[model samples]
Target: MIRPDHPASFLEEGPFRTEEDQYFWKALVELTAMEETNQGNLAAFVGVSQGYVSKILAGKQVPKARLRRRFAEFFELAYEDMVALGRQHLESMGYPAEGLPGRRCQVREPAYGGAEAAGRPAAGQGEYSALRSMVRDLRAREAREGTYTEIPLREATASMGGGSTETGDRTLSYLSFRTEWIRSKGNPEYMTAIRAFGDSMEPTIADGSVVLIDEGRRQFVKNKVYYLRYNGQMYIKRLVDAGGRLGIASDSDNNLLLVSDADDFEIIGRCIWTARELD
Candidate 1:
């Protein structure tokens, strides 16, 4: 671990109080060092002079907010993830939890392939990862802050029968939709795309159907289908009022499962649209 060798602090006085300020900067500097490389490469990655990288490593400088985003890219992490990590580190170092990140964010370990696994140094994984993140963030940011609207096509499948265990939640890609069209359904921010498995909802929602879900619509609406989790299993089924109880049903088979208060049920979203491959 590269210890802070210089006396300069990384942040200006503001959000953090005096007592907590020291640990905040200390945590950030140490976290940044975990991704540090040779001086020249580090400077190039951050688009800064070698001297700036040196000063930063020595804890004598703080990157601006935009540059922090670059650091996030370099570290192959979201900016919010970095902040959450720094908060966790600070708490571990005996700093108070108040005024830090309100929620915990999990930092996933990066998977390395052949070369690194064979005891060789990484071949520009940092640069490549940073570039990918930059492009992905740019596209998502454009959709969020500009006129465009893009819904994420998640890499997941919801079963129509017994229930499918969700494999992953990564965004495989995005599906562009008209801003006006999305608004007519629900909030654009809550929209996502996932595939449905099994023929249980066939004739209504077929097997291999790409379903558009509005995750914000968690309220129970009678006769509406939903992507939900029941007892730790994922499903796409119509929700109905079962006389003060909740009912889950498959369309094609007309199978119904009533939920009691003791059952664990969570509504992920309301299905608003669907598409299936012709073949």
Candidate 2:
């Protein structure tokens, strides 16, 4: 709902392209406005001067050198995630980022919370000291250009059975993995994480499993589970390519839907990884 006061044409050229830079800075401003007192509060949070924050917000500058770590830290985002935003700088400057970072800053030492802080060190310098490695990793990630990509996990769940289910439209968060780690599996950029609902797939894919989908692999592949949308509802089913037609199979021994045309349903993506809590 919040629009930028200045258009991209009016912004100064800096570390990031105009639109990308604005999204980064604007998001920070809006997200923290509720928790921070002002630009000064945010500046203090990142160990930067208020003017620096103003320049960034006004699209006059970008986080330079080690400031990236500090900025990520303020957001409690990891060095990898912060650097990922400036990937163009990485590619242009020849920064290597093979491993992908991609998490928020180290666990907050009570000062912050979230997955990053789940097992963080106790209060004080102990925690800050641990962050040095994160900063170092971030530096490497930036310098080498990350090899991993972040796949968003929409808070939405894709149904695997039980008729139909609504999908989550909002991106709740992200999960990062090594591009090399999954390249053999599929295109890293085509990846996304969605929760599974219902019991159509059951034992093979539990009702609460976190399913990783390859958005690029929409074409039917035999015996492989894929994310599909039918009748405005989403479902995950093992599909087979029968010449020009498609056949969807459920692991729960349910009946299959045989289609004479490939366009009968929408292929959201292919399931690559399935993670679920063990009872």
Q: Pick the candidate with the highest lDDT.
A: 1
* Model 2 residue 239 lDDT score: 89
lDDT of 1 by residue, 110-167 (tens): 2222335535355355634543354356446645645557899998889988798885
What would the TM-score be for candidate 2 when compared with the true structure?
0.48
User: Per-residue alpha-carbon lDDT of model 2 for 1-279, expressed as tens digits?
Assistant: 222333233244344544444335533433343233356767888788988777665545667647756776676556556544444322433323332111121111122233234363333335333333544566576544456667798876787775456676688888777767878888776778988887889788988899999899887668888888876677888887656567778888867777654444788888988888688
TM-score of each: 0.48, 0.48
Q: What is the lDDT of candidate 2?
A: 0.62
Off by over 4 Å in 1: 1-148
Give Cα-based local distance difference scores for all models: 0.68, 0.62
| Top-TM-score structure, candidate number | 1
